[model samples]
Target chain A: MLKVENINMSYGDLQVLWDVSFEVNEGEIVVLVGANGAGKSSILKTISGLQKVSSGKIKFDNDDLTIIDPAEIIKKGVVHVPEARRLFNEMTVEENLIMGSLHGEAKEKRNETIKKCYDLFPRLKERQKQAAGTLSGGEQQMVAVARGLMSLPKLLMLDEPSLGLAPVLVQDIFDIIKGIRQQGITVLLVEQNVQTTLKFCDRAYVLENGKITLEGTGKDLLNNEHVREAYLGI
Target chain B: MDLFLQSLVSGLLIGGLYAIIGIGMTLIMGVLKIINLAHGQILMVAMYITWVLWHTWGLDPYLSIFITIPLVFVFAEGLSKYLLHPLIEKDSILPENQVLMTVGIGMVLVELARSIFTSDYRSIQTSYTDKSLYIGNISLSLPLVIAFIIAIILTVGLFYLLAKTDLGRSIRATAQDKFSATLMGISAAKITILTYGLGSALDAAAGSLLLPVYYLYPDVGPLFTVKAFVITILGGLGSTVGAIAGGLVLGIAETFGATYISSGYRDATGLVIFLIVLVFFPGGLKRFTKV
Candidate 1:
């Protein structure tokens, strides 16, 4: 489980996150739904140690994440698949996956994990030798997710995994997220595709202007008047 | 015909050594995204180390490689760790502080060498320094031939490390995308330090290889630093394969220019080629080869 307690984040003089707070229970897919610039990505970044918080704490299974080095954070089973699928563009597809499992147990089981990743994304195996930049948008997203899996993460944080993906590929990505949950890996997802994400997530939180404004079970949020009007557009 | 063949042979041979020098700068540039202005100065320090070993210990310049590489690696590692690495965190107004820091490092190194060595041109005398092997009307300098072989071996060894090894992969990964690499648990700071050290180690190798035939002075670092810079640009910013080609092209071009256009214009010839590449190829040989 992960707990984010009243974290305030800022870049230089401009405050982006104002005492934001949220949590994710074990073995559940938690979705953070918000408009553009609502600080969804900022929350994920602060949790991953890529960005520092001005106040409050981020705890993953009771480990103080604020002081941990960004590189060391991943070793504690918090693998963040960042927004836009920032794969090593010049490296081969397989090389990108190899980069994922570079520390500790993941490194030791590298070969097996790579095999598992290839099985999960057979298209990637076929294009294993090709440069990652040359892959299609959908395939690149798959590579990013598969790369996250290669780290053998107990809790995976996905930041807009479906951004820029086509509608058909978007469905495939959502299916993969469901499958990931079935494997008992907890997921923290930030999404712009609110309707589809709301239907599947165990719980959903509405992030508005850097603060958590609403939280409820998936069904409760689906019928909420404010959620339907702003996000679902019904 | 004979003169052309002779110069061509010598150029290619020396180019092998130049490739090692270029590769070092290229690696540092690729990973750190900063032009290491101190590259040649570090090489100069290594040459001085090699010279000291030869003068005081009677060790062959080639044999001193075992000593010079580790010494230079640690030295450069410390230089970057203590001086350059800290600049990354400083909220300086000028973003070019890291590159400027290298310039300061170079100046200090040159001054240090001058105070101790007194600017006297130093060359090591070995049995093979002046000897050459003949084939019909063309001859090869024995020292150069040996250095060329060593250069080739080092090049091949480096290729293996970059292509097949885990450290090499991490280095290349860091070079391609520092943020993503860190997200994968790679300490980009550690990689930057290691890369600076490794790059200088290669420079040390080139310096040792040059010592038997080349003269060394306190300010000799700038000349090769410029050469490394030209080659890195000529090879396209951070491409490894391009560095080798760039070195060879510059070497052959300089020799050909010396032979045909006049020896005084040899350095100018390389500059001319560099400008032409800048105007035409722009991306260096990597634009053509896609390496």
Candidate 2:
């Protein structure tokens, strides 16, 4: 489980995230939906230890995350699949996956993990020898996902995986996220595609202007007028 | 015919040394995007280090590689961490600004070498000097041959390291995208320092090898540095293998230019090729690897 309490993030004098709080139970998919600049990505970044929170605490299990280094935070089973699919463009799809598995697990398990990733995204296996930069948008997204899986994180935090992806591919990506949860990895997803996200997530939060506007069960949020009007376009 | 052939052989032999040094220049530039103007000065410093190791400790210049390369690597790392690293870290240091920094560093190094070592030409003569083996009508000097062999080995070895190993992969990644490398848990600060150190160490190796072949002087690096610049730009900025080929081409051009044209301005011929490449082919020659 993960806990974020009263986290405040800022850039110079501009506050990005103000007193934001959220949580994820073990093996559950919790999504944060927001428009651009709503601080959905910022939340993921703060939890991943990339951004310095001005105040408050981020907890993984029972341990305080502020003191841990980003690399060590990842090793402690919190892997972040960054937005824009920042793959090692010059490297093969396989090599990029290997790099993700750099810090955690044994060599043998790493291989097994690669095979599992390949099973999940067979396109990556087919293009194992190809450079990641050349992959199609959907395939590149798969590599990015499969790469994050290499670390075998207890909680996988994905930042805008569906960005720039087509609507059909967006469904496929969300289905993959469902499969990842089935594999027993808890996910904290940030998404702009609100309708699909609510359908897939068990619980959800709508972030508005760096503040949590509402929180409820997936079904409740789907039927809520503000959520329906603002996000779902009902 | 003998004159042409003689220059050709000697050209190939010395070309190896240029390739070795050029690879270092290219490597550092590729990662840091800093044109190391003082690159030649580092070679001069290495030459001085080799000379000191030879005179004080009574070690052969060739045998002193173990001490020279590592020391240079450490020195280069420390130098970047303290001096150049700060400027590079600021993110304002572009390729053009880096050229200035390198030149500034080179001036300091050259002046330092000038003050301590003096400008007097120094050479370490061994029993093998002038000892050349003759096969058919061709004559091969031992030291020149050794320089070629060492250059080839180091160039090939570095290319392999950069292209094959995980650390090398990390370096390449840092070279292309610093932020993305960090996302993968690779440290840019650490990589830059190591890359600077590795590049400086290569300069040390070349300086030590060339110490006997050429006289060691504070200002000696400028000539070779110019040659290195031409070689790197002509071959390709980021390609190690390109540097090697560029070195060989420059070497052959200089030798043949000296033979067919004029020996005094052999460097001019190399410069001319540089200008042509600049005018027509801006990318130089990229040794692109298939992933």
Candidate 3:
């Protein structure tokens, strides 16, 4: 489980996140839906220790994550697949995965975990020797997710995994997310594909202008009046 | 034809030593994204250490390498950790404050060596220092041939470490994307320290290898610093394979210039090739290898 309470973040004088608060229960796929510049990515970056927060606390399983080093946060089983996939462009697909398990227990079980990742994305296995940058958008997304899995995360945070993928590829990525949930890892996803993400998530929150505007069960939020009007356009 | 053959063979031999020096600069540049201006100064310090062991303890230059390399590694790691890494966090007006800081460090190191050694030209005199091997009309300098073999062994070892180790993967990952590497649980700070240290150790090898033939003076550091940078640019910045090629190209060019053109223009040869590479193959040899 993860808890982010009343967190405020800023870049120099420009504040981005204001009093943002959220939680994810164990094994739940929690989705944070927002428009561009709604601070969804900022929230994830803060939790992952990539960005400093002005106020409030981020706790994963009752341990304070805000003050720790980013690498230490990853050791606490919080693996973040950041925006744009951020794969090591020159590295082979397999080397990128190997990097995911660079420290601690994950390193000891790296071979087994890599085998599991290849099973989840067989296409990656076929292209393991190829440079990650050379892969298609869909395959690169798979590599990103599989790389996150290599860390054996307790809470996996993904930012815009389906951002630039085709509609058919987007569906496949969501299916993989569902498969990941079935494997019992809690996922906190920030996505722009609101309708599909809402349909897939267990609980969802709509973030606007750096604050949560609405929270409900996935089906309820999908059918909500303002959600349907502004996001779904129905 | 004989002169050309002789120069070519001699150039290749000396190029092996230059490759070691270039590899050190390339590794540091790759991981830290800064030109360590103090690089040749660090090599200067290592040479002094080698000289001290030789002068006082009567140890061979080759025998002193095992001691000097690790000593320089620790020294460089401390410099990176306590000096360079701290500058990264401090807010500064100049984006190249780290690079500027290396220039200051180099000055301090050169001054320190000067105060102790007094800028006198010193060379190690071993039993094989002036020995040579002959094949028909061409001859190979014994010290250079030995240094070349050692350089090849060290280079192969370095490539193995980079390609086949956990620490190496973390280092490459950090070089590629510092943020993603940290997210994967790699301590970027630690990797930077290790990389600086490793780079310094390679410089140690180069310093020791060159001592038997090259003269050592406090002012020698700037000359080598320029040579290392030229090789880095000529090979393409941060590419190990490119550094090797750059080293050979520079070595051959300098030898041929001395033999065929004019001895006074030997040092200018590397500069001329560096300019050509800058204009034509801006990415260095990495563009060709695509590595």
Candidate 4:
């Protein structure tokens, strides 16, 4: 239920996203696979209102996402779990989760929502009192995801949730994403782990040099020769 | 030994007030990541407000905190939201433009106070102004003891707010990661303004408390601004707990210096300790406490 139309984004004079457009229907796990500097992160950033597009529009379930504040975008039920997990390192894990649901309905259901998050990642419940920075990378990722869920969003956009995790932990994170989808929450994931992400994602887009070069079902792209050679390295 | 005990007691008492001021600066510094050159100026204005309340209505300096806090909070909020926040949005060549703007704000505040108050040193006399409480060899100023008790209450209250309240969590979160805070629907701009207002409110409380025990003028803010930053650095940048310790350390050092060494070297004593702390404990007391 999200549409990004012909968005051109830049940093100063250097343009990073040129006429990039994509869509994710409700309840789907959409993945954007690209190499470093391919503008995958930039697209997510623009959608979340962290960076504004110079041209074109972003419409989310009929709301004009382009013209609103970033905080307002979250209120519209679109939450972004940014790259690097970005947990408030100094704050306790529970405190970090509390930060995620600071407005409206999410805030009202804060205690209940936190209980749900802890149930999703019981390990976080165990380390609830510990500072977020002290957690393992896997645990920190869980906090980041759990924190995102705390927002009670219709759509959760995650950027590189498995970036620094161990191989085993990476699979676990992928499984968590699937579990999230099963809970009726839509996910838009940006990842460099093409083979793994492609296997699980409902649909996938191939971004190269600020452009969406290809889009298809996950299985379609996995079997495509260009995708195998360029991304999966198969 | 009696003299030493006396200075130590008095130093600890005064340090409580200093901690309040430092805590305010630390909150602003932690969230906005600016030096806040106008911090002491805000306190100065609060003192003047307190002075006016006393001079006009004969309100006790202690009772004036309620009025001064909300007044300074709104004024400081406007300063941060209108003056500093906009500068951050602009594409300035120097990233320090926001900081420079605070310096300008401080100048304006000082000038405004000068125009109105005319640089005159003003002090208030209450029933307890000259009274002291004697504990055998040590005598404590009554006003200072009351300020100290109030300072303790306020510090505890602030700690509770930061540790338990949602607004405090948003503040700490924004201080830690502004982008992430926004993604979580915590408006960093509003948080910044709130933090500035909260910080100034604490400063106002300190100013009101200090009125019965100290003299104030338009130029009084610069000295306290230096002290606030020194306390901020001493306590460790952005650590509320550290600010308290930093303020106490400074208060004790200055008092001891005045007692043992030449009284003229009291301010210099705090500077010496500040430099030493910068060199040895660059992380401030946070390095030790990890708070």
Top-DockQ structure, candidate number: 3
Q: What tens-digit string does per-residue lDDT give for candidate 4 at B216-287?
A: 999998888999989999999888889999999999999999888889999999999999999998999878
Off by over 4 Å in 4: none
Estimate, for each residue in B123-184, the C-alpha lDDT of model 2 and write its tens digit: 99888877997867878889989878887788778878877777888888788777656666
Q: What is the DockQ of candidate 3?
A: 0.87
Off by over 4 Å in 1: none
Candidate 2 vs 3: which has more TM-score: 3
Interface RMSD (Cα, Å) for model 4: 0.8
Docking class of 3: high
User: TM-score of chain A for candidate 1?
Assistant: 0.99
Minimal lDDT window, size 10, model 1 chain B: B281-290
Residues A60-128 of candidate 4 have per-residue lDDT tens digits of: 998979899888888899989889999999999999998888889999999999999998899999999
What's the TM-score of each model vs. the native? 0.98, 0.93, 0.98, 0.98
Tens digits of per-residue lDDT, candidate 3, B87-174, equal 9888989989999989999999999999999988998899999899999999999989988998999999999998899888888888
Which should have the higher DockQ, number 1 or number 2?
Answer: 1
- List model 2 lDDT by residue over A106-150, tens digit each: 234888999999999988899999989999999999998888888
Off by over 4 Å in 2: A106-108, B1-6, B88-100, B287-291
lDDT of 3 by residue, A1-234 (tens): 899999999989999999999999999999999899999999999999999999999989979999998888888999999999999988999999998887789999999999999999999999999999999988998999999999999999999999899999999999999999999999999999999999989999999999899999999999999999989999
TM-score-superior candidate, 2 or 4: 4
Residue B153, model 2, lDDT: 83
